[model samples]
Target: MTTLLAARSDRPVQFLWGTNVLVEEAALQDIVRDDVRLPEAGPTCEDLAPARFVTNPAALEEVFLAGMNAVARMDGAPPITSVVVRIQGWREGHGIPAAAESSPYVGWCCLFATPAPSTAESGCLSLADPRAGSDLTAMPGLPWGRQVLIRPVPGALAIAPGWLTHSVVPIEHGQQLVMAVATCSR
Candidate 1:
């Protein structure tokens, strides 16, 4: 079995990940349906974006608590006071590269839900290893030099090395709603 290693602060950069386990489609829909205006990337609109994070602060708090507990179980680290979840668009650049190897920051997790596809298995998160090689240098604020698509399941989440280059595949045909929250030890 491949065991996950706790990130050493002295490493170039690292991330610990966790999730809230139960983000129902109906709950997502409720947030989207109640929106007065949809999030725009111009012409195209995402039915549900990450804005609902603040809409239900209490729920987020619960998620925060749960996520912290999960992280503590894995890393033996304490919980953080707050986190930020951002709704990302397909065209948005994954910010894995910008963080410098010498930077003192850890990693983040992007939690999402997607419908299963016909004629194929469903709910898989995509990834690109950020530490594959330092051959490719990155600008300050970008994640991977190339794109890595991840499709995680409902009530399921992936906790990979934070600096690992990664992103979500476009939820093209399915009714997928996504939310990404970043957590760190206090």
Candidate 2:
């Protein structure tokens, strides 16, 4: 696992990302197929509870646990005791809206699949600065008010703080698939 972005005194965002090779190809294929087969709930995307449909639930949970442990170690916090996983398939011209997880949840992790051919602007994850009034001033050599954009890559896994506001860029050409996990410590 790699620390894509580490939280510092100046910048509070802590983002950990890496590619998980432990998940077998068959399992990923199964997940994509299952997501595709699910009925669309809205005009822009399809959502499914992965735990209820995934063929290898244990393997999926193991992946989540790996991310959770990494997050716990980084924050010097207690071990994560719960996770809620969801499979989201986004259609062209649509993406997830900006939002942050509520109380009881400490953070969120996401696993990505190889999306259909698209540019960096399509389906990229956007993490906003959490500091209040940081956007009011733009100064050189400062991390304040800056936004981080992570492009979607196959097998990519990212874990970030729940309080950090985040959103996804719209799919420009093809569909984008993601397995989103919400982590919490009891």
Candidate 3:
């Protein structure tokens, strides 16, 4: 029998997941429209949204900070150094495939898989088993055997360690929007 332990760190992976209405739809729309223009491409998701980046919209910063605090508490307080923000979009045919990898930052905040009011299918997040070998950590965009797709709630924030390999599942229908925040500590 494949026994699964419910202990926090002993599990295949560990992450902070919560739902809070922190940002508004209108605000989110504006952020995407007026604020997403980056001088250059963001960190590779393919370091992240710059290795350290935040939302141009102040309203979204509060939401990101809240997530940072939660992840910080889980980890004994570390001095945060930088933050980066970016918006990721997905449609029926185009989506980022999963891989076995982790981030280079101290923590990351992502509002993954936003709902498509016009569609019924929900996109899911496939996270690799934390217990897997380190080889998996560097090879992102490639799928592994042990991973799971998690459905995300709009307005809910997912704050997790920088080293957990995760990716968005192929969106079968409609569009999926995401607000990504990456942070570093020194």
Best of the candidates, lDDT: 2
lDDT tens digits by residue: candidate 1, 1-186: 122345678864334222112222223322322432323343222324445533654454455445555655555555555544444332222122223222111222333433454413232344554443333335322234433334444334344434444444433444343444444434
Top of the candidates by TM-score: 2
RMSD of each: 9.5, 7.5, 9.6
Q: Model 1 off-target regions past 4 Å?
A: 1-55, 88-124, 128-154, 173-176
lDDT of 3 by residue, 20-136 (tens): 112222224433333322233223233225222333445565555555655666456664444545545444554455443244332223444434434333455545544433333
lDDT (10s digit) by residue, model 2, range 1-186? 233455688987765332221221222444433543423344566665665446666566666666666666656767776676666655567777877776333333334544454576677777664444323245322234356676665455556667666788877654545545545554
Which lDDT value does model 1 have at 31? 31
Candidate 2: worst 10 consecutive residues by lDDT? 18-27
Report every candidate's CA lDDT.
0.38, 0.54, 0.43
Model 3 poorest ten-residue lDDT run: 17-26
TM-score of model 2 (CA atoms): 0.64
| Residue 25 miss distance in model 1 (angstroms) | 12
Question: Which runs of model 3 end up more than 4 angstroms from their true locations?
Answer: 1-56, 100-122, 133-148
